[model samples]
Target chain A: MAEFFTNPLVQSVLVPVAGGFILTGAIRFANGRAKGPLVAGAAVALGFLVGYVLIVGLPPLPPVSNQQKLAYVVAGGLIIGFLMDFSRRPPFYRELVYIVGAAAALYWMALPKIAGGTAWTYLSLVALWIAAGLIGYRLEKSRANVVNACAPLLVAALGLGLVALFGRTGSYSQLAFSLATAFGGFMLWNWPIARYPFGATLLLGGAGALVTIAYALALYTEASPYALAMLLLCFFAEPVARRIKLPAGKIGEAFRPVAVGAVALIPALAAVAVAYLTAPGQEAGY
Target chain B: MRTRSIIAGAAALMASTALIGTASAADNYKIDATHTNIIFIVDHLGFSNMIGQFQSFEGNFSFDGKSVEGASVKLTIKTASVDTDHEARDKHLSSPDFFNVQEFPEMSFTSTKFEATGDKTAKMTGDLTMLGVTKPVTLDVTFNKADKFPMDPNVFIAGFSAKGTVNRQDFGMKYAAGAIGDNIGLWIEAEGHKQ
Candidate 1:
């Protein structure tokens, strides 16, 4: 239990829940408009719970081979989805939720062999992000909201440029890849890209990418079973901040979603450098 | 008595001729660097296999009726020639993890004993010194063929191949546990000619 206190996964999971309550409570205390935050919280919790049931519970309804082991993964996915959904109200909050969730997933997934583990994952991620950013840009262009469309594309391009040049390291690389991939997938189905966006698409894809990259890269050396679910911190940060009524709009909102994503990238890029330096020479076989 | 003496003298001359033929038939052959290879393989993150070969080596051998009467080999592998396609990992292998070329410049293997096991097979024992660790290793060897070169009769050619396994840790080389297996499998193919 004490270990859980220090674990990233536990913190990530609880932050959103606590934030939801605080958001609703704060809104009630400040503006007496608790309804929006409360509804958002309930939607997040419901989305998370339902998503968990569908993703984790449904797959092994009859109890397949590794149902018990998959319990945490399923639960994590649910929480992430809930958080992403919960942040939907302020628009930028929703984007922040997705970005944080995606970033967290990426960082956790890329491990010991960061370059070998996340290079390809990063490539695929960058490609997806570019596509999504493009779609978002095109949509905004159609509506003459060129700024919004250009925003995602510009951010994505900058992120891609950074990744291509320096490459990601340590825990951060995994998260970066996850965030990029998730954002891309989300754009493919969401507002500007899709007429109807499934609530769990970005949440699940982002979380799943995190798992796959970590599993593929074997980056779980520092990872706990719950580390995967910890993106809820970023996911819920915006909603929680909104409930507190932090002043600012548009640019502030846009920046909020990417804040945690950027933090997550630092450690990831560092890890990549460390792993590359430590491993040094190439193996006989490629 | 005179006839018997003549016959005995003729038999003595015949015996001497046979001895000379056997002596000149088996010539000592030196490794021809133009044709020799030392290769290795290892698993890369349980995902793919990486393969590469060393560029240079030297070998020496001589045989008599499938028996290795005398044989010795010395090989110097150029540390810089290591390649595994991926630029990053390749650089690492040449670093402190495995080769550590800076501290221990060259890896060498010298054979001290050769024991014939069958008509074309033998177990060659040698000391493989790498990263300052010297360990006795036995290699499974096949004595392929030895004969006068078609182009140059003065230089006789002899070919052989040997295989062995050495623990990387045994040589003070350590790295990824699951990524690169400990027991590094190595194979060498060589041909030698009278120098």
Candidate 2:
């Protein structure tokens, strides 16, 4: 029992879930507006803050590059807030905002690689972020917060697996855990009848987390390209689920997230298989 | 008697000149990267010690036999160059939990003081900066030898070996503290050529 509690996986899952619940409950109580864009925006902001605090305190933080990535996360949140405010605006105006938001997120997501003078890497990361953001946006539009939130959770699980397989720990892994926990917390409010929409939060947070995971794998881990390809492919789950027909009412509602999750799992499992088979030796060379 | 006095005075002048030359023998040297190595050791779950090293580094030093304070050394290591024999482990070491190589790509040490403890050894104090955190550390350094390279006499070489221990927590590396040892031992063997 002590060992279980001490386990990083447990801490990663439990802390954020508890924090998310507390934060969401507090916001609901304070504002008395359980539904709408404002509540959703507030929930996203609080969830991220709480999750960040629980995972990594400000004092002994990760590297500056990872730290700078937070700015992108905040920028993503702000974009969502803007979208929520102008939701009733003309379609053209909303589309413009999304375009600008995507561009900004892509730039910030690829900033480290860009600064490192790896143009190809930067371009590839931008493409991946755009794809992820689109998938998340489409899912949110379909009123499927559960599916949107689950994307990050899946990616986080993969990161944790990678850590265990390699027997190494780092900030990327910690961030992955935080992301998973945050989404887990978000899920409680998101299920049955969502207290608030998690569209923007999922898009921004998911993209940010995925980008970090990809970079960590590419730069540090000996994970095969196929593994990374599978990870990226998981983002298509939302689009695929949109095509599925299901029974109406609560059954369909619950089934929607499950369907999306199943689609994602296919690629995720494949990535794991590739990684396990091609795993490198435990020795490092200078 | 007058001739004897002149001979003694010449001899004294020669002796003074030789002493002055020895006092000013402090030579500046550039690090010979090919021959210098920066190695480290950390405890792994109390099972065994895990040894590692950095592949890319550069350093320089000024050796002064006359005054220990005149001696100074500086080294800069690429944090991403860390190797523990495993690609995955090395990658993890360079990740944000430890070096955060993407952000703080370089770790450096600059000597602040050198106290001669014996004819061939000294205590060197320096500031080691990693992950944007700087801390003062002392290394027990031993001068192995100084001579012209056998292959290339034109290049004068100086060799030194140093050992130190630093608490990883001090540099903000507090991940898996109980599982991995906090204190990391550093062992460096360096060779520099006179510039």
Q: By TM-score, who's the top model here?
A: 2
Per-candidate RMSD, Å:
19.0, 6.4
Candidate lDDT (C-alpha), each: 0.46, 0.65
CA shift of A41, model 1, Å: 47
Indicate the worst ten consecutive residues by lDDT in candidate 2 chain A: A34-43
Residue B83 in model 1: lDDT: 61
- Which ten-residue region of model 2 chain B has the weakest summed lDDT? B63-72
lDDT of 1 by residue, B1-195 (tens): 999999999999999998787676656667787787788877666786677666655556655534574656666666655666566554445544456444355678888898888888889998998866688888888888788889988777888899888787666554343346777778888888765
| lDDT of model number 1 | 0.46
What tens digits encode model 2's per-residue C-alpha lDDT throughout B1-195? 999999999999999998787667778899998999899999999999999999999889998644666789999999989988777777667666677776677999999999899888889999999877899999999999888899988989989999999999788776675678999999999999998
For model 2, the docking class works out as: acceptable
| Model 1 interface RMSD, one decimal | 15.6
Pairs with backbone N, CA or C atoms under 3 Å apart (clashes), candidate 2:
A283-B85, A283-B86, A284-B84, A284-B85, A284-B86, A285-B85
